[model samples]
Target chain A: MAQSRNADGNGVPPVGGPGAVSLALTVNDITRTVRAEPRLTLAEALRGPLGLTGTKIACDRGACSACTVWLDGVPVCSCMILAIEVGQRRVTTIEGLAEGERLHPVQAAFVAHDAVQCGFCTPGMVMSCAALLAHTKQPSADAVTAAISGHLCRCGTYPHVIAATVAAGAETKGDGP
Target chain B: MNRFALAHARTIADAAARATTTVADAMTAARSNATRPASLIKAGGIDVLDLMKENLLAPDMLVSLRDVAGLDTITEAPDGGLRIGAMVTLGALAAHDMVRRRYPALAAALAGAASPQIRHVATLGGNLLQRPRCWYFRAAAFHCLRKGGGHCFAISGESQYHAIFDNRPCAIVHPSSAASVLVALDAAIELVDADDTIRRLPLASFFVAPGRDTERENDLRPREILTAILLPPPAAGLCTAYLRQGERSAFDWPLAEVAVALVRNEESLCVHAVIVLGAAAPVPYRAQAAEAALLGRRVDDNAARAAARAAMEGATPLPRNGYKLPLFEALVHRAIMAAVAETL
Candidate 1:
């Protein structure tokens, strides 16, 4: 929070912008400093500056969920938030959803059920579905439906995604999200 | 999106002072080119970023309200009502226990809004003030009336998803469905200006008809910041419901929406009623004639049918958007029936 040109006593002044600024961002449990423009979106920063292409950017707008990421454990469109505005909120992308050398339950189920086609919306879809399982132990089909309602799957794998999410929820051994 | 300086404010007064200054600069710039906002206030950045990306309004500075204290909470109001911070996200409002149990209609409206990701980041204040999703207005290539052009392209061009009522030169419908429910609930909004002067107004008055102003959507003054939404105390016999018809069940903007608030006695006679239509007009269309048909009468299938017919009165739909009439009629009837069925 202290890394700002606008750290005046009254309040923060206008920081960053129009020019490239060195900004620190915590991604996948590691804080990486990147130099980028203020107008650059978090999705762009993650994929470009941070070199994490796992978080795809299809629409580059909020219309698509291809850029979905966890901002403090809640699913939000990465394209909707400015990279500079992410501040201290820890961003968890598709890359951080798995354990060491092991895919998350939702990711494993996606593979098992063949829920990937073009795989453009896969990362975002997986991020939202995984967030749902973190809280719901046994999410029903409707719960999965509601969780991924914002996601657009051109592959028409709605049934497969729902099945994979429900199976992942049921397969979880303990309270882990 | 243009590269702009991000200004953070810690207090309401600080935000307002910076906001007023920003607006003054923005208006001055608007006088010449009117291509962008000089300095803009951003809540969730959902709509603001959309505008910036589409080249509608670029800002030299964005006064971020994300750091403002006490603006991201939901607490009980002194009048025994719910005081929702302007920054409260739709996701939090929908998942809130009290909002779901006591104000089911509001929760339902919130649930039907946008997608999960949008509901998580889009704030209440930002939703109320979001720009119309009209294609012409959004496309930078075409300069429409809202964009300081002479004519509204939707009036002569594609208007399949446009408004059916109260749309004059600008045919685009209001984008928010929650604004309808809030008006039905008789909510109020608190606004604080740069002078630290806070004032409240009925939520109904907050929306601005296109006839009144072609560009501005709501009564939000650039110099003022909406701090909170004050919901009235729950009435014992009140029943409320919100329903919408859209292209898709989820993730699509509503084609037509209806929100109803009815206060009926134990015998099921209506004592008071409010029916506000969303995505059907330039603002939340208050169907006063529809409400009149239900006053002092037993709310039944016959009453619902009569009110539905009355609600569609005075509609002047443009070409290719007449389908909204039947959609609004059906939604109003279903919403009325749905509101009454809550107690059952």
Candidate 2:
């Protein structure tokens, strides 16, 4: 069994003890390194040290998709993942959706379809929809619904969200926007 | 969530070694101290993180198996079966063309699970080993029997979502929808112990009954890692289907779920059948009486109804969950009919 040791080869405290470890991650195409406790979640690390507050934490648990992010091109609940486990994977949050001032197709479509009501679940929904459109250029209504099924919108903006995702999927198949 | 140390295991051996060492150190420390810290293995962290946030589990060390290599591959076995690694995510399993074409029941169960984001992150092994979502057990206020308390609160308290069958001292239903389909498909689990010795356990004997062991829901020992799940080759003329009834259409636990795998003979008579029910018991309940009812019988309304009725022969449901009996019957009947329809 491997024992916990510091960089100088000194015996450190057992795992889960009060000790800070250095974590390096590539978030939104920038390499970032931060020292945090082992218990720090990716969502906490992103919002706290990385200053990427676009990924919101609603339920904190995996039940809600409020803290959704793209890990290695797949959508995952950032709140459920430990910061240390992220390692060298590419992390994409809600703030990374656009290229600059211009909004992503899904983001633009959400605004066009009036899908944002409370604006709490918008980031996670956009991330999920963006990931879906990244893989499927022309997704059906059912596909769009399945992509964001885990998300909870108290304002009941599901119909608009589905319409926005499908429209964005269609837009991706066309010319540059 | 409590403060815990984290250790990333690079290999299966490393993960087992770290878990064993951590558990041993915790035990040694407990001998001299009043508190006994625990160690837990995290694969997907979907369920573990929830339990930790709820204050249900507070481990001293979390052995992360995420960096472990070769534990995420799903390969076809030499005997024409499928060998799925423990770390395979539900989304990948659901989207695999082989799984969709060959084992439609398993595919349906995977697709109908938690949500798209959850399926993308939740691994197959972690999903099977997830703790019960029973409100009494989840809330730290209630010290139920499963938490090593004296009594079970769900027995006399609110049990609308509790188990209706195989619920004795505890009433929490099995939370895994994949378990019922796996049991119907006759899958086996491969476990690697702390000593690095591997053992294969039949899926039927994996989950323990509630009364048999209130402390643990499964037979997996501490520091033992579930490495892979082995599925047998599909039988000829076999057709399978899965059906679940939940309060919401998505992101909700099933109230009653059923999986049926039926093999028909040349004359359209049932040759073999396995009917498994979920959310109705503490463990996945295999309806032996129902399977027997379908033997040598045509896949018609009468046979389906007979099998469905036989499934709940000795079910003793609680006051609130009595509706589950009929729900199980209907689901089982529908699942069997769906499977039969697939053959046609």
Candidate 3:
């Protein structure tokens, strides 16, 4: 939770000048320092600067779930959050979900249930479902819908998404992962 | 898209000190800049960023409140009430065990709002304090009264989404779906000023009618921030519910919504009642007559019908919004009946 930035006198005025800022972010158990444009959102910073483009950017605003990530354990639209303001908070993107190619239960359910169509909204949907399953091991159908309601998919694949979430919960019933 | 410069605040006190003082201050700040400079109170930036990209908003400076510590908590008061911080996101409040158990209506309202991603980012303060979502206001071409134009186009133009009650000069309806439930629960808001001065007032008193001031919707000024929402403990034996009937399940504003919170006394008689109508007025309409109709009476089918009938008594419909009256009446009836049945 501790973060510090260098006051390099590179601060630009209100309109347009310098494009980047010195930011320190701890993402997925790795503390990485990067210079990002002031206009660059956390989503863009992770995808562009850190080379983790798994965090998609669909609406470019908070409305779409393509850029969703867990900021300090709470899922938020990374596009809405400025990269510089992210400081040293822990960020968990979809890239951080698996351990050495072994798919997480949510990911396995998504694969087993054929939830990814077009695959653009998969990262965000999987992350949101994982967050829900983290809190509730066996969530009902309504809970799954509410969890993913903030995400929008033009593919119209809600039924499959719900199935994947329920399957993930059932698979984790023994270990309660 | 052009580059956006930043004015970051290190603390809440620092942020408040840098904010413009009043409407006049905002206008002056806008003129002093080479561009259309305005203050975007960065409460989660859920709605602000979208409005900006849509060109509906182009503020020169963004004053962020996210750095304000102690403004993202959900705690139970010693009096058994709940105090929700302004910066608390809809997802956090909805997932809170206390909110889910004590005020199920509030939890339901939060859950029913935008998608999971949106709920995760949209703050409770921004959800209530955000402006109405009138198409005329959002579209740059319309330039309606809400956009500082002289006439409200919703009256003469496309008004299918306009108000059904308490709209005088402007007919735009309030866009908050959570506010209806909050007001129905007799919630109060804790407003904090730049000087650290604070005031706690009922949520109903926070809204201003269009007849009073079309230029603004609430009593909030430039420097004041909605710090907390205080929900009085649910009355004993109460069962509250929020019914929002919208054009679509997700992302669309409510066409008609009702929030009913009621409790019966030891004698199985109505002791407390609250009914609020959404998408009907400039603000969340407190169904005063409907509440009066149910006072001290058994919340049976007949009483619910009478209350619903009285709810639409003061509605003044426009050309096309006349349909909202019946819709709102039926919604209120259903909500009350559900609440009553749960209490039994």
Chain A alone, model 1, TM-score? 0.93
Model 1 CAPRI rating? medium
Q: What is the lDDT of residue B232 in candidate 3?
A: 88
Which of 1 and 2 is ahead in DockQ? 1
Candidate 3 chain B: worst 10 consecutive residues by lDDT? Answer: B22-31
* Tens digit of per-residue lDDT, candidate 2, span B22-124: 2212222222233544666889988877877877666777888887788899999999999999999999999998899999999999999998888988999
Cα TM-score per model: 0.95, 0.94, 0.88
Off by over 4 Å in 1: A1-4, A12-14, B20-37
Task: Tell me the spans in candidate 2 whose CA falls farther than 4 Å from its real position.
Answer: A1-18, A174-177, B20-36
Candidate 3 wrong stretches, greater than 4 Å:
A1-19, A174-177, B1-11, B21-37, B235-239, B263-271
Which tens-of-lDDT digit does each residue in A16-66 have in candidate 2?
334777678899999988988878999999999999999999988877899
Give the Cα-based TM-score of candidate 3 against the true structure. Answer: 0.88
Candidate 2 fnat reads 0.67
**Tens digits of per-residue lDDT for model 3, B169-209:** 89988888889999988899998776778888999999888
Q: DockQ for each candidate?
A: 0.72, 0.53, 0.38
Q: What Cα-based lDDT does every candidate model obtain?
A: 0.85, 0.85, 0.79
